[model samples]
Target: MIEEPKTGMNIIVKTVTRLTTGLILLFGIYIVFHGHILSEGGFAGGVVIALSFIHLMLAYGREIVLKKMSEKVSELLGNIGAVIFIIIAVLGLFTGGYLFFDFFGKGKPFNLFSAGLMPLYNIAISLIVGAGLFTVFVTLVFFRSEKK
Candidate 1:
């Protein structure tokens, strides 16, 4: 008797992906939040976050991953991130006479809230990077190469 093909990877891989996906996502978020105090920043953290979703797509199928985060949603998120970043810059310009000026108060040194607008910038950047990369990945996955 012939068996049907599986849509995604084998059960072992799927189980491992299921276990590790959340941890990857959390680690990315941690990197984004602690970037000012630590070495890693939004760009690094955003790549990690995007990797988590890509991991899911690789372990599962595109359909399953797309169900969780559709291309439209990813694009929308990226646009929203850009808008938020711009808004913050505009607010800073109006308040401090320069674009992206640190208008917020700088709290205690070595503290989580010490960076003024830096943390907010990191969050926005993470959103932009994560969504943009994910969208690109999806588009590449759907791209079809024609045979000569």
Candidate 2:
């Protein structure tokens, strides 16, 4: 019987990535589940959720893979997600007629489904973050490595 070579990561890196990814997912679930109670806001919660996977990449990604992932799409998407958050904040100007208004607060703390367009931004952040991590990992694994 033939055995397959490891895809990329060493045993320790793979183990670390698995553990970190699991923990991050747990933390993200915690934040998303209770974001309203804490009043930390959904967008922030979404970012926290997204960052959890990023931690995995940083911990376990191969050197070449990490460099490539860090340099390109991951970085681009990270910045874009950041910009999206800013844009969401800027959108408040239109809704509140000023910056950082209640934005459908209606004088009461909103539930998970309560926040107006804030949820939309939250979803967007989640998309960017998840995609950023996925992109980095997929690219790194599939990318052809140049011989040193």
Candidate 3:
């Protein structure tokens, strides 16, 4: 019988990782969305989000993680996040608000969508941080040059 090439860690490790990865991702999303009301904000939430992917990479090896999130995709997402953040900031100028303005009306306290553009800003920042960190990690880990 031909043995399959080893791709990741032992079965127990993989099983535990599979059980927790989704929870980690969900926690990151929660942090991003509730940032305006809660203490956790864009950067913190973004790091958490990035950690989820990083955890996957660690458990499954670089190849599988790359397949799920390639370098190109990560770079593109990082750029898109930056653009979205810039657009949101610039939009304030046209609305007669400050450079970093909150254009939307504040709803009930401690509620999602209450902080207007803050949530959007948090989301944009999360995307930038998560994708950018992952891209950097991947490039550093996978693209080593061989000496002649």
Candidate 4:
């Protein structure tokens, strides 16, 4: 027998998923881009993105493979992205006079993927943080055993 969805369920689920997804993506994009300006860019952004994904999962009941994939991809991108940022700083430290100093040797922020790899670092951290949250949520929410 097919269990018909309650009238309000669809509305509730759709509204929640759409809003969560949009907010996450928006904030994620904002953080990813702004890493150059602020200190914690990619990692923070990725975490925001992941939290948003979890909200979607809860609202939509896991019928969101595309959304899930997007979340996974975001995590990956964030990790690599943020790592590059740290690497850039380390490289600068080695070659340049000071730590995390890219202005002297590398091209300015205007150049291609410039900013001394700050953007990349933001992406990497964002992904890792987001993924970490996702993993925790899944373990607690899904794999968690309910006590009768």
Candidate 5:
């Protein structure tokens, strides 16, 4: 008798991944949101976010992961993030007479809303980095060399 190949990891890894995936994702979001108030910033948060998705892909198969976030969607998100950043910059230029100028008033120090557009920038950066990294990962995973 011949044994069939498995598409994903064993049951234990799957169960563990299922339990931790959401937590990992949530942590990434937290980092993105609270970055200004803490040590970590958008880049760090974005990498964490991408890691969550990558974790899912590692535990499950590509098919399952792709269903959750298709290649098109990832590409679209990255574009949207870039557009948002550009819009923010343009708005700053028009309002403050400079690129990325902080027109909005900064709130109380040590507060969530204290960073006057920094948070928005962080969000955009996070989206870009997360989507870009995930797309790259997917591409690398799916890439295959043809042999004649």
Candidate 6:
């Protein structure tokens, strides 16, 4: 007997998405890490990460995706990202002797973890963007549900 239809797109679409979402997430991370060395930056990479989750939602529906990542978790993560960014700035003032100074050592050239505060900044920005966007999407999706 055929299985009942689930709460998402067609099987084919879901399969394709499953295959590609991982790659998309990987690419997003790469962009965030190599942003300084390459063209992309935190904002771009964060958007990509957010899009990967969004892609899953589009293919799998909010219930399934939300189960994996709850609204509170997303909001909390976004808040943590913001806090990290602020802490970095504040630390710079006290440790580096200037506002937004590079307190962390600048390691080898063209290497990961080489740019002192830059990588940290990128990570913080990525967290903020990715979680913030995903939270927005979840809120809007659920908002509509309550109305109905």
Superposed model 1: Cα runs more than 4 Å off: 1-5, 143-148
Best TM-score among the predictions, by candidate number:
6
Model 4 C-alpha lDDT per residue in residues 48-146, reported as the tens digit of each score: 877777777666665464355644564565466567757777877788678777554456555546655566656666666777677667656765665
TM-score of 2: 0.47
Runs of candidate 2 with Cα error greater than 4 angstroms are 1-20, 29-33, 39-70, 105-110, 115-148
By how many angstroms RMSD does model 1 differ from the true structure? 3.1
Every model: Cα RMSD to truth: 3.1, 6.4, 2.4, 5.1, 3.2, 1.5
Q: Which ten residues in a row have the lowest lDDT in candidate 6?
A: 139-148
lDDT of 5 by residue, 26-144 (tens): 99999999989999899999999999999999888888989999988998999999999999999999999999999988989899988799899999999999999999988877644
Across residues 9-126, which tens digit of lDDT does each residue of candidate 1 receive? 8878888999999999999999999999999899999999999999999988888988999999999999998999999999999998999889889989899888799998999999
Measured by TM-score, how close is model 1 to the native structure?
0.91
Tens digits of lDDT, candidate 6, 1-148: 6575678888889989999999999999999999878878999999999999999999988788888888899899889999999999999899868889887788888987787788888999999999999988887776677855
Q: In candidate 6, which residue pairs get closer than 3 Å at backbone N, Cα or C atoms, i.e. clash? A: none
Better-scoring candidate (lDDT), 3 or 6 = 6
- Candidate 1 lDDT for residue 19: 99
The segments of candidate 6 whose C-alpha lies over 4 angstroms from its true place after superposition are: none
lDDT for model 1, on a 0 to 1 scale?
0.91
**lDDT minimum window of 10 residues, candidate 2:** 1-10
Clashing pairs in 2: none
TM-score between candidate 5 and the true structure: 0.92
